[model samples]
Target: MNKLIEQQIETLVEPLVSEKGLELVNVEYVKEGAHWYLRLYIDKEGGVDMDDCTDVSHAVSEMLDTKNPIPQAYMLEVSSPGLERPLKKEEDFKRFQGSLVMVHTLSQFQGFKKFSGTLVGLINDEIVLEYENKRVAIPRDLVKKTHLLLDF
Candidate 1:
């Protein structure tokens, strides 16, 4: 049910995002305690601001309300994916090259599931990373999650 709702939302919002030159990062429909939340994470080359959020929110909200896609009510949230955004796509890894990223593997590598450092390269379906003064190649399929890291 949730997946279907997400699909519908994605279909409904694709036009709006493209029209505004924004990238739709992800969408989630989840229940937190008593509240149902439909969260939309968006981004672009220059990053998104509140005005962009507001516009997307208004447009999506109206569309959802009209279609009545979900049987239950949900609070809609449209916003940026943030600096530590998840690297879920190959395009993301390609675009974020040379940036710091943290990756968690499905199984332990070097006796650990988590690895953090610079994303040196992504080639041949593997991610090359430099961490702890050593370079390691991690298979892309092994990564359970990958997120950008903030450097101060």
Candidate 2:
């Protein structure tokens, strides 16, 4: 159900953001405390600002209101992906190649659930990372989240 809602949202917002010359980094439908939230993480060449957020929020809000794709009540949010921007697509892996990253898998692998290391880019269908003087190839399907890690 949550996946469907997020898919519906991404389908609606991806092209809209693209048309605005921005990237829709991610979309999430999550429950926090007593509220449900639809979060849209966006980015541009120099990163997004408050005005970008507001504009996207207003545009998405209007679209959501018109389409009524979601069946439940939720708060809409638009914002940047922050320093630890997620690496979602193949291009992201290529663009951020050699950068530091942290990857979390859906289940434990190699006696660990998370790894912090230098991204070796997507090789074949795996996210290769060099950590602790060794390299590991994590199956992309097993990766629950992959984000750039900030050293500072």
Candidate 3:
């Protein structure tokens, strides 16, 4: 159900984000205690500002109100992906090449499930990471999650 809602929201907002010269990084639908939340992660070349978030929030709120796809009440939030942004799409990997990243896999690789290193980008459906003075290729399908690593 959460996945379905996320998909619907993503489909509905993709065009709107693009129209605003922004990129829709991701959408998440989740319940926290008694409340539900619909979170939208957005980005652009220079990154998002308060006005950008407010604009997207207003636009998405209007669209959701009209569509009424979600039966229950939920808080809608639109904001930037932040410094440690998630690396979700293939293009994200390519774009963030040479940046530091942290990756976790569904299963262990080289006796470890998590690794942090310099991102070498995507190659042959694998994410190459330069870690421990070596280049390690992690199969894309095996990755559970990945995000940029904040140096500070």
In model 3, pairs of residues that clash are: none
Error of 1 at 130 (Å): 2.0
The per-candidate count of clashes, in order, stands at 0, 0, 0
Error of 2 at 2 (Å): 0.9
lDDT of 2 by residue, 1-152 (tens): 99898988999899889999999999999999999999999999989999999999999999999999988899999999999999997889999999999999999988889999999989989999998889999999999999999987
lDDT (tens digit, per residue) of candidate 3 on 2-55? 999899989999999899999999899999999999999999998999999999
Give all candidates' CA lDDT scores: 0.88, 0.94, 0.94
Query: What is the C-alpha lDDT profile of model 1 across 1-152, one tens digit per residue?
Result: 88788888888888888898888888889999999999999998889999999998998898888888889878999999998998877788888898999989999987889999999878898888898899988998888888899998
* C-alpha RMSD by candidate, in order: 2.3, 1.0, 1.3
Cα lDDT, model 2, residue 150: 91
Task: List the candidates' TM-scores in order.
Answer: 0.83, 0.96, 0.93
Model 1 Cα displacement at 33 (Å)?
A: 1.2
